[model samples]
Target: MAAIIKPWEGTFPPFRMYGNLYFVGTQPASVHIVDTGEGLCMLDTGYQHSLYIVLDNMYRMGLNPHDVKLILLTHGHIDHFGAARALRELTGAKIALGAADREYATGELDLSYAKELDMTYTETFDPDILLSDGDEITLGNTTFTAIATPGHTPGAMSYVFPVTDGEKTFVAGLHGGMGINTMCREFLDAYGLSYDCRDKFQAAMDRLKEIHVDIFLGNHMQHNDTAGKYKAIGAGNQYACVVPGEWIEYAEWAKQNMLQMVERENQR
Candidate 1:
């Protein structure tokens, strides 16, 4: 909690993961771009302080900020949606967030976990689209289905969509949030949040395990070894991010990790 986040210090070079999807975020947080042919669909906007870097990354990737038609957030956390308002204003992109996490974005509930990360959430705005489970967000040639995956947050959501590389199409999945900071006993008891989110988190992981994801997208760079894959792509592996078995492995690991934390807390 004492960590001071210097958003600018975490800039990473942007590159295309596969097909029309591109990575344009920093080391601390991950941002993705979906070139839907008609307009761009931005996955999560990183911290507000690092917005300029994200924009610069977009330009570096040959993407137009003005053509961003949608800013779809994976959850309500500040690190994920901190730059939403400013970005929407700049691109006129409609901001879409999970329905359960609406209050986190609007500042109605001081639970964006900003303070926990040693930051403050100042850019709050109403989401143009309040997505629910099974909701579909369509733009141009791409459509993403929203799946409710709570536990990380009450409104955490995972998106599944199809991406194409001209001749072949691959299914891509972006998991919302998996950090245990909010679900851990210390954090829950301190914030007066329920412990039920742990159960929800475990269930969400199980549910996600059943889904077929060819390309697993991580909200943070470490979750997917984005840097390693980026280098691999540079070395001529065009489909470096595609690992159909990764989804199940990550989901199981996340579920077991949560269970272990709870067990440790009980022992304490």
Candidate 2:
């Protein structure tokens, strides 16, 4: 029997978020394309089945797949890295993933949770670039600095870069992982994770607050209200640019939520 796919895993119409950034994936997983003048750099790839949607949206926007120079993955989750292999084959682009995720993706480490969820695993492939904390990846005029934001996964990485809306340029940050899906004691114990997982998650959030982010994004739409913000952008709302304080507020909210989860786990 085939597993039922969630509605959010379906395709979504792509739209330009700002100057060079475009949203081109479903509501469940976000795939962003940044035009770098010299070529294109992609951030995240939805499920493998959703690659056609991503490619079609790019084509509709008059972007050729051949022009894709880099494919940056936020993490090793199936939803985020599922289509990476296909994209690399189609575009011959250099694929990059955080060191930890790269190990998981290339079969160096086993992701037991994926087996528990009955999710499809990404085809093993060696990443062309292995990212580390404070590493910078430059392609043409765009430079993305990788920030180690470990919470969802040990190697979860966020990216900070400059994004423009033609009239103005703002420092944009895309948070790699936002959910505490594996934070519970049961899951942590089964996965052999240390009790300090919660503490590390909190520290990551603390470090994120220190970064000034005028435009904040998340790997999933639900994390940062991508659909809501996209609608506002379509309606010509200038407030869609987002403010730095909003990032701090969101980080605080995430931290509080995780802490609450930890409290509940303790009571259990």
Candidate 3:
């Protein structure tokens, strides 16, 4: 289990990943802001304790938190949606989460995986919008299509959308929850959760491989080497995150990793 004694310790400098898509999250969790012509669409608010850092990062980047019209969560984990209630109160942004993760967000179940991080989820709130597969959330100039990618937490949702750079457009896909920590046999047995989630995870990964993603976004910084790519950006590669083939490769690896884990458990 990962213990985060100080959520604020993982602060990172925010920057723009593409045109209107900006990376405003911290070093631990990845948060993004889409400057839709109408308003801002925030993807994944990090830990509640670190919300002030996110807000500060947005202000430093000249992005106003009050302009946030939508808070689209990738999952219902505390590290991802822990600050949703506070953010909504501050900006009145409508919170949207996967339909299956509704209870997770509402604190009805202690399934936000907060215990894994040695924390408690005390900032839960009812989501304004419960998302399903193929649901398209349209803001001013952007439309995010939600793809149900359960397993990580049952209602983990991947999203695909078009990112424009004024002169050109590219498709970006954010994998909802790829971590198999919760899907492991011991974890499942401890929680009395079904083993079927492993099957769903494999299927979800396979289906994601079919989509064409120009840019791959990760909910966690390490998944896509956010730091390394940011360094490459400083070295003058403005489009460092736009590698077309990386998404498919990562998707395949994620599937294989899970399979290997299950294999190891079965062997034991």
Candidate 4:
């Protein structure tokens, strides 16, 4: 991952992940908190002092005393789950996530993160929870299905949050790296455009369509950052790559992009 990436730090509506995971990064970065009324679940906790930032957000947003029933890490990346252990201490929440990621988090399994890979690991640790694909986790009247989508990391997983707003049923795709972010921009660039790499990513991303995502959200807020991390980047001349709307657009985009790449690879 791009180590130079800034932690989540800023204000509200300031950042919204794929319009699915609503959150704003702060100065020191904040915990990516998702609260469905009394139900609260953190997709991923950020770096040091970041947990408190989320706690602070809870107060500001009137979402504190948040029933953080569970902490679901999208993967074992340092930035993604560095503060997870702390949340268990602060919120007393149950941790449920991917089994493969659990291996990487606990240090039982270790993979060297290279520049091309856009990840740097000084250390690796084990996760408390080892979840498998098709496992459904319930927290505060809500249930999130674990769908293993490994590409960024051997064990990368995305959580499908079941949220109902009025008459609309929202299925949120909570991935650690669902879309382009500060980390992936550099990582994708560093990795270059090799047919092998493209093929692999295409294969990995092909699994995205297998699941239903009405709202696409990654661990980070910005969909893509051609500029500063927080700046929205999608649209004409826009360096940011996100627009607030239904998550279906994101789901379609991911599938179409993967297919497009696969088609190009076949053409070549």
List the global CA lDDT of all models: 0.91, 0.81, 0.91, 0.54
TM value for model 3: 0.97
Model 3, runs deviating above 4 Å: 1-3
For residues 68-115, write the lDDT of model 1, one tens digit per residue: 999889999988999999988888899999999999999999999898
lDDT of 2 by residue, 1-268 (tens): 1211553346677878778888888866788999988899999887777777888889988888789999988888777887888889988999988887777788676762456557657576788998899999999888999998877777889998987767788887888787787677777887787778678889999999999998887787777778888789889986585666877888888899999998887788
TM-scores, all candidates, are 0.97, 0.92, 0.97, 0.65
Task: Find the 10 residues in a row with the least total lDDT in model 2.
Answer: 1-10
Name model 2 segments beyond 4 Å from true: 1-9
Candidate 4 local lDDT, 72-136, one digit each (tens): 77776666666666667667777765776666566554432322245555444445678877788
What pairs collide in candidate 2? none
Give the better candidate number (2 or 3) by TM-score: 3
CA error at residue 126 for candidate 1, angstroms = 0.7
Candidate 3, poorest ten consecutive residues by summed lDDT? 1-10
lDDT over C-alpha atoms for residue 169 of model 2:
86
